[model samples]
Target: MTTEFSPRLFERDSEIRALGEGLLACALPREAWTHEAHLGACLWLLSERPDIDVDAEIGGIIRRFNESVGGVNDDTQGYHDSITRAYVAGVRLFLSETTATSLVERVNAMLLSDVGRRDWPLRFYSRELLFSVPARRGFVEPDRMPLPVAHK
Candidate 1:
């Protein structure tokens, strides 16, 4: 979880589109799976690929992609349900709030905002709670503050 982070994820709209395409195809490189890339993928999928249900299918998509990249999805490792849900919801909300003409512009704006922080979740969940086994295994209510997006 202490991975190096970049404030900016993409330089162009095509990069974001590529991220979404790579994610769905499970061809995204291991190193390319950064926090910004995660959010960027949400942008593309939600904004462009209306055929795919981003929130409903994100977990399986991420799990499959993780496995394709030789990663594990156990409680402490690959995917964390609550964190991913929060981010996807945040990205959804961001899209709803912004009027950016392109995906990359929206992603860049997000990178410059609080959501860009690697510790963005900490604003809603306690560190201990967010990284706990339950949070990793499935979605759990935040112990700190409510997420901006109303989530089940």
Candidate 2:
């Protein structure tokens, strides 16, 4: 999304765009849906696809992709809304003050940042609250810290 996030993963903006395109079309293989890919697609959506209302569309997008991959969005698995939205918020914050000019560079730098970590949200949300069924189903406020975007 922002420049390349990880040199080992994405080398160009088009690659990230392709990831978003495949995801949007439900054409990406389940095995290709890695954590980095998730962030990559979201970053593409956030940074390049301004036409998309990411906050509103992200859940449906995830649900559709999950179903296409035979993943169930039930109480225990798939389509985590809280985590998704939190990352959107985090990505927004990161991009707002970013210095990179290319999408790929920004993504790589972001991956190198704290927000790139799989456990980034844990800094704001308690493990119990973040991984709860409610959290997986819908957006839940952070119990540990307010999101920087939410501070507005």
Candidate 3:
């Protein structure tokens, strides 16, 4: 990723990480997970006018949410899992309406550009396409991509 694009992705990830850490530090019950904390974070990020400070706001929310419930694990594993799930859901919700074609185009461009860089091997990702898009000529060849294994 270029400096510009990487910052956006990192910003999103960092916000989620801080929120998770705050949750782990606070005394909260599992009920805290249902408090719409993830939605709040997503709304703030995607809002038209983001007045609140990112880290401080997310941390405060997580802490308060935890305080509302009984405290749970305050360690890396707990925080990491919560953050990952929240981030994945947020991305899916946020990007739902975006066209698959656009996603494919931008991703291909990014990959092609990065592939030529010395740092190419350091970055890797795989995503299973759960939905099908009509194949378009000159865009991508479905035959060239491996299909995801069928889940029983």
Candidate 4:
């Protein structure tokens, strides 16, 4: 099977990662799916559409600014080289750009949407894929803590 590589696909990968990281920052489970699983989900989305060419498919929506910028990451190669790891990095890029609340809402919408539930292979999507990603995102600070006692 030929894997199509295009600027758009990389862009989408970046978008998805951004969305995921943003949602995760607010309240995504610390351990739900593995890093590989996240990548698998995206891969399935790209390949699942038979009409669309996996390589040609745009992984994300293209933006006006990006057109002139060219090349999402300087060091990272195209999607074919490191699919999972690249996707993971996209997540961080996304987190930096957006807020957590909207991210959660978007994720919920995607999860509930029809496209999200359609059957896809689970081998990579399963918990095993977790290893592909980091356990904690630098300084696992608690979301909240009890209020400090008032001074007398």
Q: Which candidate wins on lDDT? A: 2
Q: Model 4 misses residue 73 by how many Å?
A: 27
Per-residue alpha-carbon lDDT of candidate 1 for residues 1-152, written as tens digits (9 for 90 to 100): 47565685577888888888999999999999988888888777877898998768989999999999999999789989999888876777777777687778988987766676778888899999999999998899888888887333
* Candidate 3 local lDDT, 18-136, one digit each (tens): 44444545543465353233443343343322564443355444445544565443432122222323333333344443343343332223223432232322222112211122211
Per-candidate TM equals: 0.90, 0.91, 0.29, 0.21
Segments of candidate 1 deviating more than 4 angstroms: 1-6, 150-152
Give residue 48's error in model 3 in angstroms.
Answer: 5.8
Q: Quantify all predictions' global Cα lDDT against the true fold.
A: 0.84, 0.87, 0.35, 0.32
TM-score leader? 2
Q: Which stretches of candidate 3 lie over 4 Å from their true place?
A: 1-32, 35-37, 76-152
> Which pairs clash inside model 3?
27-70, 27-71, 28-70, 28-71, 29-69, 29-70
Worst 10 residues of 1 by lDDT: 1-10
In model 1, pairs of residues that clash are none
lDDT of 1: 0.84
lDDT of 2 by residue, 50-146 (tens): 9999999999998999999999999999899999988998888878877888989888777778778788898899999999999998899999998
Off by over 4 Å in 2: 1-8, 150-152
Clashes of each: 0, 14, 6, 9
How much is 138 displaced in model 3, in angstroms? 43
